[model samples]
Target: MVRLSRFVRQTFLSFVAVSCVVASAPSHADGTAGWESVKEAGVLRCGAAVAPPYVMRDPKTGEYSGFFSELCRNFGQNVLKVKVEFVDTTWDNIVAGLQSNKWDLSMALNDTPEREKAISFSAPATDYNVSFVYNRNNPKIAKGAHSIAEIDKPGVTVAVMSGSAQDKAITAVFKQAQIMRLPGNDETRLALMSKRADLLADANTTNMLLTEAHPDWAVAIQPNPPLAQQEVAFGIRKDTPAADIAVLNKYVSEQVSSGAVNRLIKTSVQSMLASNK
Candidate 1:
């Protein structure tokens, strides 16, 4: 009877201990299913479109470089303690890639309502200026237009990258102007350089870097500014658990506050200019 009682008590204690361990295990309430799968695989998949200043491809090594790529690496290496796998994607398919679970997140996208409907965005990591650029040889722009809107008219053609902030804004504000939607960011510059388009609409960093390389193009940035500033953020899937989004947002805020974005812009200008050479 004494042995029976001891065995019963031990069995009950063991069952309770196992139950407690199971109950205390982390779940979707605390962590993300996507992140959990990533952690298990030990690889963080990042979607990259390979746009300059934001995401540049190292021509020789087939490796990725630039501000957004570095930022993604920082998160994967430091925050998640995992290796990163950058998956090639295009801006037009960025949202679709995330929705299909092809990658965990997209890099340095300008957060917008259309994107928000397809996927979620982290808190504003940084903001960028979007402006117009024209070949210095274009006499109309050379006449010194004071306002971005001043250049918008029926005859003016603007070269824009498909599925970009500049593309959307130009379509919205300049109904009379012609928009030539190129396949990618590089093609917009080509269109302007070849005089196929009168103006090139892109982010300031891209315009600055290219202008430095060309010295033949001029930015049409107004002193008081023309367009509203756009927010840059990591693009995550909406189904990602809240904890993952919170982590990304916190890290982005810290990076922004630490002067990382500004530093990156300065460094990228130099590095990208060198790449152009």
Candidate 2:
């Protein structure tokens, strides 16, 4: 009986020792968090595409400033404790940059299935309701046409920003339209204002901003139900460590819940509008 009791005690003690060893070791065995590498590199390479009010880059100064730019700076300074190096990218090639490890984080990116194959997105950072802006005097279609399908007929010029989710969305529903791919919102707006493009289709923010600046145009949005809801978020490579994804998503949710993100958005929009004056 004494020998049996000693054996049982020894086994219990061995189990406790193994548990302690396992618990003391790191959570992951092989890979470090992607942000850990950023910390080690002393700078988080950030992708900033020139989507105004969302991301704006100064060419001469190599400076980035906008809602997403500030938010990324906050993440680098407060969360990662690293400097952020903004790399200018275009609407179409931004996901490619992330997939190729050119940037650690994308400032503001749309979540789509095509992009998901290359990179993973954080929880939604913001939402954009799609709208269509067009010249009221355009003679191609009825002025009373409301639905996108009504304007999807051939010869209707739809100006879309290349490499944008808007480009995809418009192309999907307007198969017969004459789709003109432009580089950015500014150019797309110009196409619509100059009557070269019959329709400027994109997120409400861009369309509304352009409509406000150009009073001659009219916007059509389905008020009872939105035409499309685009969720904008930050993106990282698919192989990014789970811990880093958790940390980034947590930080974004925290900022959103605390209303800081909304306030910053208002400030950025106001700043952009004021500058256009």
Candidate 3:
């Protein structure tokens, strides 16, 4: 009788264990719980901060555009079969917004070790590096300055967008120079134009736009090895399933491999230049 009781108890325990495992398993075979939630809602929310060529918002019409935003819209409408919503945010809160579930993806975030601890990233849409933009005739900067050390000296001031990757990078490297952190890209560019700052530290591509806008005065220099050389990717919550990330990765890979990303960038640049003119 005791042997019979023991057998029954063992069987019950086994059944319970199996039930628990089944309950814990993802409902979908793809392991796309997060994505499923997004699909159910019928909208893919993308967090955006205005970093030109990456993210841009029209001041008058409140429309969102730029390469990354375009990718977001395309991925949502075409790949996920949903509507896209751009949630305006600042660089300081872009990652936090993703963490809090305020948005499904943070657009155009630079994937770095510091951010990886808090959130996951999709495959890179493009490479990113920091460069310094300054007036070619500026007496503070050397005629042929190619290294950061030449710019990192007392009495020289460098302007960067507040709470941006370039801000953090230049802060670490420029011990002797004053780092003037502004709230936005326009503010930083205006600082350089007004002589409030001597150097504008920003993304290499962004500085390219600045130089193009003011070719007579603005010129950019990329450091030899590069600063904050990293990948710009979409930021998602850390708990996001690998399958969901894979979907994003595949889409980004397709765009990059087919040269679609380059076309988007060119279009954005041309639009920006035309507006400036």
Q: List per-prediction Cα lDDT, in the order shown.
A: 0.73, 0.73, 0.83
Q: Point to the candidate with the largest TM-score.
A: 3
Clashes of each: 0, 0, 0
Estimate TM-scores for all models: 0.83, 0.83, 0.87
Residues 50-123, candidate 3: write the lDDT tens digits. Answer: 98988988999999989999999999999879999999988888888788878889999887778888987777
Q: Which regions of candidate 3 fall more than 4 Å away from where they truly are?
A: 1-33
TM-score of model 1 (CA atoms) = 0.83
lDDT of 2 by residue, 1-277 (tens): 1133423343344334323321121212232337667776788778887776788666578777778888899999998798878987888888887777777888788777678778887766678766788777778767777777788888889888898888887777777889999988778878987889888888777666666766755755442256557678898878865556667776776777799988888787777777668
Model 1 spans with C-alpha error above 4 angstroms:
1-33, 223-225
Better TM-score candidate (2, 3): 3
Q: List the residue pairs that clash in candidate 1.
A: none
lDDT of 2: 0.73
Instruction: Write the number of the candidate with greater lDDT, choosing between 1 and 3.
Output: 3
Alpha carbon deviation, residue 95, candidate 2 (Å): 0.8
Would you list the clashing residue pairs of candidate 3?
A: none
